[model samples]
Target: MGDLAFEPPRGGPTLWEIGIPDRSAAEFYIPDPDPNYINKLYVNHPDRFRQYGLWARYTDLYPDGDLVYTVGVSDYKTDWFFAQVTRKKDDDKYEGTTWQIKFNLETVNQTGTYKLRIALATAYVAELQVRVNNQNSNPPLFTTGLIGHDNTITRHGIHGIYRLYSIDVNGALLMEGENTIFLTQPMSSSALQGLMYDYIRLEAPPPNNSTKKI
Candidate 1:
């Protein structure tokens, strides 16, 4: 089969298609939102990492090999997202492959709910885990098994939208400061074809300002 890269629809008619109509819609479609409820930080694309204008490290790979890196962004084919981690033919198969994206929380030392929307494409059991402050070797937060058999759908590209919203079993949000969220796929020839990561979005609940007297 020819490698197909599906492009998301243009934004111009999304509101209308979704049934939000007319002039007052301007308020409904606030591009540059003023600080308010539900602060959202969407890691939808590799380039979005640069917009913060900070020197924070955004992408990293372990046991580097051929086909294991981020590519340029495209509307559809080649480079729209991170490629699957593939091992070179000469490399030991047992070495395994992993890719991670980090988010540094500035509004820390607080308590609230957190959520993540990730798109992953694969044919193997992929481990989705979160480690806070580079500690805690607990089991993965979620495991995505074979695609069709396990509630996975091909919504964008070959990947399916996997939404994770919950406090870890330890009852903690990714920690107050630097926390690393990792996605690991075990060693297999199937993995060699690639474990595509389309996008990830991390969102936090709004701060509780209700207690303050107005």
Candidate 2:
């Protein structure tokens, strides 16, 4: 429900609580990510087109979205990550997809609610995975449906943005030590021209349920 981006440094401790927030204008429904729950979301069409930064679509090949970057993700010519949509029509229910990330830690003590933060930033489109130790925390993952998709982009598409829904663990890492985190993002299906990436970070809970206000 909050934004914790551009903090001190990377691989360091995370924000105490109030995990990352969704930069998109669309409404999100995540019970909040943790080491346990494998959440799945359905991003309805016309709506994906109706709300958020994806406010409009282009007339490239299909009725898809576009990456905001001047260079394409596969262009290898620039540093920007472009995330477009592959769907042709606007009524498709969209399809299901998954991105795998790996994280490794020195002590495996980096325990907390890990989230797969998905923003529309096209620059972060590479296969980014963090591994703690050597285990692939949880699978099944999350995605937006592609029922009405046209699958004509032939390039990466943006279905929805995900974030690290870090749920608080009562200092669980103290029980272990070091850890790693993984992040993997495929191309989007729509043909729109834009990329989005909000900040992805971990969180800790506030004490006694005080100092909190939505």
Candidate 3:
């Protein structure tokens, strides 16, 4: 063996990435603990997410509507809430929520399949449905049906079990200019049923010459 070399398989080129893939949502916005439910150990601490009742803040932050995030203009640290949870209703019931992410593309690949990579920091009896462009798509683009039991939200923890999903997006569903991706968590029996996203990314279709050995 004069020389030995190995090259890993290449997936595709990343078009855009949101949040860091560190198996935790710590990088995202972590609001201060409510004054009524403060944990002194976490006050003004980096692990502010560990404080109790952080999940309830979602309703307080956006009382009238759900989250609408614009890629270029919004700042993840301040705009992206750490978790996607249900909203409390005046009837003393909880309801599901849908968050939107809007982005723009100068061009699109008409004949190739794009990949949407989503990493979950934690989940608790939740179903995540993803829809591209068409918010009312009956079947949706992808769905994680009834996943996870890691009650990280109520336990005052930042993360628990980690999961990653790669969804194939048909090129035809994308547009040349403005596009929107909707993330819906449809399990609302309890406030604890939710998901914390670790990271999310979209990849352009691989080129014909994607594989190479060097």
Candidate 4:
């Protein structure tokens, strides 16, 4: 018989997982359609996300600020906005938004590198910047410099081409207490230039043990 050996999966050990790893954001919060701009065909349908003007509802929901999701407390279905889009101004202009994900860490591993896995369901001419702890870091921890051209948001589609990013986060960036990860889509040329996140996860360093075989 030929030799057969089993190897462990790639990537580091998972420390904390946020949201499902499925290539869609259907599990996240989907706002109800505006009564003034409703589509009869999609009303009460499973694809309620196809309703028009759902993007504009972000302004109505949070008139003053962007979305801030607290890990242990906030409910993704009720709190996490479906899309990270621009905030509308009273002058009829649009501005880029920065979303914050807050979580607490009990301890730190100063010698090991961490992994941040981000999956995007869709993106429309957007640039995503990632910053750990500090929101105004001159050079962000990681940045997807001007990525995606799929106009899935306006089409009312839940997703487009799938894109996954694995970022290596240095241990120095993290602390032993509360940490906040800032996700900024700094493209405001059009309101449609935004991003829809499929899932996000933070992983711990790999163990020192050897691989297993079967």
Measured against the true structure, the TM-scores of the candidates, in listed sequence, are 0.44, 0.28, 0.91, 0.90
Q: Rank candidates by TM-score, best first.
A: 3, 4, 1, 2
Weakest lDDT window of 10 consecutive positions for candidate 3 = 205-214
* Model 3 whole-model lDDT (C-alpha atoms): 0.87
State the weakest 10-residue window (summed lDDT) of model 1.
Answer: 14-23
lDDT by residue (134-210, candidate 3, tens digit) is 99999988998999888899887878899889899877788888999999999999988899999888888887633
Candidate 4 has what TM-score?
0.90
Q: Model 3 clash pairs? A: none
Per lDDT, the best of the predicted structures is 3
lDDT of 4: 0.84
Point to the candidate with the largest TM-score: 3
Listed per candidate, the RMSD to the true structure in angstroms reads: 16.1, 15.6, 4.8, 5.1
For each candidate, what is the lDDT? 0.34, 0.30, 0.87, 0.84
Model 4 per-residue lDDT tens digits across residues 1-214: 8999976234687766666767887878889888898899987788878999788888899889889998889988788888888888898888899999898877677666788989999999999999999999989989999988888889888788888898988777888878899999989877788889988888877876332221
Per-residue lDDT of candidate 1, residues 168-210 (tens digit): 2221545544455555555444332334444444545444412
lDDT of 2 by residue, 1-214 (tens): 6987675323334432111244442232111123233223424332322223221222222233322221112221122222322334446433212222222222322333333333332332223323333334444133332222222122223334343332233234322322323333334443332233434444333232222211
Which runs of model 3 end up more than 4 angstroms from their true locations? 1-10, 209-214
Ranking by lDDT: 3, 4, 1, 2
